[model samples]
Target: MSETKTTVFRDLLAATKDGDWGKGESRQGHVPAYVIRGTDFAEVRRGCIAGVPIRYLAEKTVHRRLLRADDILIETAGGSRDRPTGRTVLISQEILDAFPGDVTCASFARFLRVDPVAASPRYVYWYLQYLYARGDMWTHQVQHTGVARFQFTRFAGTEEVPLPVRAEQDAIAAVLGALDDKIAVNERIATTADSMCDLIFQSRAQQHASVPMSRLLHPILGGTPDRKNESYWGGSVPWASAKDVVNATVGVLASTEEHITETATQNSRAKTLRPGSVVLTARGTVGAVARMVMPAAINQSCYAFEPGRMPAAVLFHMVRSAAKSMLGMAHGTVFSTVNMKTFDHVEIPNLPADVLNTLNGELASLHQLIVSHLQESRQLATLRDTLLPQLMSGRLRVKDAEKIAEEAT
Candidate 1:
């Protein structure tokens, strides 16, 4: 093992700039650009940027703040008490390739450009992730007002970064990067499988009796556990709100931002949902549906349906189709308030056993493959997270870490 030195975090940065969110519409001096908010960091890290908002920015600002490959975007503002604000995402050419125009972080975030010779940019980004994971970034966050903010200047100038030599940095990054590359490959495959399953369901779900939506799903009512009681939250059970459902782009809800205790559910209206249940948002920005991959619960804004004796992929697309019809009715005569009675009036086609059963064999096999990829990605992610801090701190040698990762792979 070799000894490593430390450097002031800001010293490695060649440049840093605050971001801009200009007028929504095009101005004389402004051009259209995709704005990356703190919220988009997770998806952007995964190589998916579909939800990154588009906003116009002054041409000069865009030129000055334009994101390049290897830059790091930090969330300088907007975090809750539980989550710290110094969240960071590494920019890549792949992310830029997916976009049509230039990219910039929103006003709430800032971007850092590290001189590659001074520090490996990917290594620095992973160091920040390591910092956040182990509660080192929490001290940088302060809540004087409503939104918690990260003290960027102080954090950069005062904090010492564990600096390994360039060769060691690259070696460490390469070992971890291989795992991420696998995760990205899995994501793309699962996403394609999701698309194929949707097409299969749409093509086959026809010529059936139209029954009230309630009969098929028997919609389990979702309710919130009392928030003030600390015992009610942050347990093993995943809890889905409307936001969770809407954010699930591939029709699979693998995790949630919050969790509730099994005890909380037993004491409150929140019910524990069975695995393979299809969850749908019934109110507020409606019509998003996803199959819960694990045992979970939901808040009042969503409904959970156990996919009993049917392929959950079938229910996933069906509920989305039903939600669209229900939303259409709401737009016409019914108001925004959707309830059990609302589901009763709006009919959904019965799952014709023969047709869906035949389709079921195909869809179930495909859905299982997607879920398998997701599970593998998750396990790889856990291994990567475990290896990170030890590698960054020089506690785990890059060669030894590679051996562990090889075994996992």
Candidate 2:
């Protein structure tokens, strides 16, 4: 790593206000189209729309500079450095075609105008993503709470970029790009799987009696101990809340963000949830569902419903099927919430025991297939990520990669 030559971000790029770019808000009348920008990167993700708003459109197309296929959108201020920073959507021809009237400019955002004379735009975009992910772009920077902010002006001002030869950049981007494409495909498959499950459950719900969650299973509430107590949250158990489960589509729990100390866990009222227990988010975008893969602690905003005389997968999907209804019933004085009674009265189909077992077996097989493809997609992604920087730097040769791919085939 010591041998790697490093370049500060500011020194390698320039923020050029192409006289053509127009702010999106001004597009009041011209066939409204829009793009969203928010603190959470996941907001732009396929299904998340809780707090994001798509407003207005490009005011003038002819006078304003249009973003081309390769242009990169950079968020300029207000985000935790480690998470999705101001950097955002990489424009593609397909995206431009999809939202022809939409474009974003200014208001604390800037476009990276690559010195095409010096580096390839694709190569630079990849480098920016790497910098964003590694948190190397912002090491020591001041963040003013309310004022327009930027860190390390050098990140936006530099003109000289270290770029691998064009051919190398193409090869590198291709490898990683292929992996991303596969991931996208897998996501579509997952969507299909979810749709199938929804159809199956909707049919069941319409034909079967409706019941609250509490009656079908025992409802357990979680508590958070005092953070000041060292022993409470320090334990190895994972403590989850509505925030933790909000948009999670799969897996028991993600080890990606936030953790509790055993001291905090012990001090708080949060209770431990068993691995197979169904987890339901009870407030603030309530009724999102997931199951714990391991024993973990949950916050009060989340409810752990342990299944009794029910198949785990069947119950999991059952709760998931009723998430919207559960959310609709929530009533709170200050914050909206699904009360325990909602779960207590939640109705589910009283399938014959044999039918329940059959459905469980069928779903188990389907889930296995979905998980397998997802795992393969992830593995391909890991391989692509491993090769990205090295390929970009010419540290690894394309010929060798081709050879490896051949051998794997």
* Per-candidate local distance difference test: 0.85, 0.60
Backbone clash tally (model 1): 0
Candidate 1 displacement at residue 389 in angstroms: 1.1
What does candidate 1's lDDT look like per residue over 122-206, in tens digits?
9998899899999988888888899898999989989898777788888888899889888888888998898888788777766
RMSD of each: 3.1, 4.8
**Lowest-sum lDDT 10-residue window in model 1:** 329-338
Please provide TM-scores, in order, for all candidate models, with all chains considered together: 0.89, 0.78
Our model 1 lands, by Cα RMSD against the true structure, at 3.1
Which candidate gets the maximum TM-score versus the true structure? 1
